[model samples]
Every structure is written in C-alpha cells, then in structure tokens.
Target: MVTGLKPEKMAYYKQLHAHAWPGVLKKIKECNIRNYSIYIQKIEGKYFLFSYFEYVGSDFKGDMAKMAADTTTRRWWKETDPTQIPLPEAAAHKQQWQIMDEVFHTE
Candidate 1:
C-alpha cells in the first residue's frame, strides 16, 4: 500500500510507529497479516510511505472486518490518519492505503 506523508507531521508519525501500540500490533497478527513493513522515501519534495504485508488468512474480508472492529485499532488509526495524504486512487476508494498490484516477486 502507498500513502503520502505530511512533511510537518513526519516526526509525530515516526514517533508513533516507533513504539506502536501493542493492541494494534496484536490485532494485525490476529488478522493473519505477516511480515509487515513500511518504508519511506522522499521524491520531488514529497514524502511517500510504502507498506508491504503478507496475508495468510482464508477470509480476507472477514479478517479486515475483525481489524476494523477493534477499538484500539480505530484509535490508532485516528492518531495516524491525519499524518497521511491519500493518493487519488486511495481517496476515491475512501482508503488511507492504496493497494498496489504486485508486479514482481521472488520467493
């Protein structure tokens, strides 16, 4: 997934994730998401965030629903969402993270 970072909010964003809430992390694991990672880059004066995770759940939608239903996750999103700027596709889809198709992967 991809999202733009607000330059002014970068510090807060990093600080929050540096010690991410345990409950949020637990919920993500409970939803069968693994190998989660986020990377940041600066290009053309803009900061972008790229996240990758492997989903190992039989019911993707159900897992997502479970994550959404977690109060702690909701609170976490509230703190983090304002630090990002959704891309056009993500905005159109009403999503903070824009899902990207895998073009190449080995292993």
Candidate 2:
C-alpha cells in the first residue's frame, strides 16, 4: 500500500516506527501479517510511503478486523494517521493506504 507523508512530520513518523510499541507489533503478527516493511521516497518534492507485507491467513477480513479491534493498534493509528496525507485514490475509497498492483516480483 502507499500513502504520502507530511514533510514536517517525517522525522516523528520515522521515530515512532523505529521503536514501534511491542503491543502493536504483537497485534500485527497475530493478524497473520508477516515480513512487513515500509519504505519512503521523495518524488517531485513529495514524500511517499510504501508498505509491504505478506498475509498468510485464509481470512483476510477477519484478520484485519482483529487487528483493528486491538486497542494498541488503534492508539498507534491515532498517532500516525495525522502524519499522513492520503492520495486521491485512497481518499475516494475512504482508506488511508491506497492499494497498488504488483507489476513485478521475484523470489
């Protein structure tokens, strides 16, 4: 998924992720998401965030619901959401992160 970062808040965002709360990390794992990673890049003076993770569960919606219901995750989002600028696509879809199509991948 992809989203934009508020330039002024980039440092704080990085700091938060650098020492993510243990409960938040535990909740993510409990949701069956693995190999999660986030990358940032600056393009045309805009900072964009890209996140990738492997979902190894059969019930995607259920896992997501579980994650969302976690208090720690909600708290985490509260802190990070303000630091993001959702792209048009995401806004249109009422989502913070816009899903992207995989053009190429190799194992």
Q: Considering every candidate listed, which one attains the maximal TM-score? A: 1
Report every candidate's CA lDDT: 0.97, 0.96
- Writing each residue's lDDT as its tens digit, candidate 1 over 18-72 gives 9999999999999999999999999999999999999999999999999999999
Which pairs of residues have clashing backbones in candidate 1? none
Error of 1 at 24 (Å): 0.4
Worst 10 residues of 1 by lDDT: 93-102
Clashing pairs counted in every model: 0, 0
Error of 1 at 28 (Å): 0.5
Once fitted onto the true fold, the runs of candidate 2 whose alpha carbons sit more than 4 angstroms away are: none
Error of 2 at 43 (Å): 0.4
lDDT of 2 at 73: 95
Candidate 2 structure quality by residue, lDDT tens digits, 26-90: 99899999999999999999999999999999999999999989989999999999999999999
RMSD of each: 0.6, 0.7
State the displacement of the C-alpha of residue 65, model 1, in Å, after optimal TM-score superposition. Answer: 0.9
Question: Residue 17 in candidate 2 has what lDDT?
Answer: 98
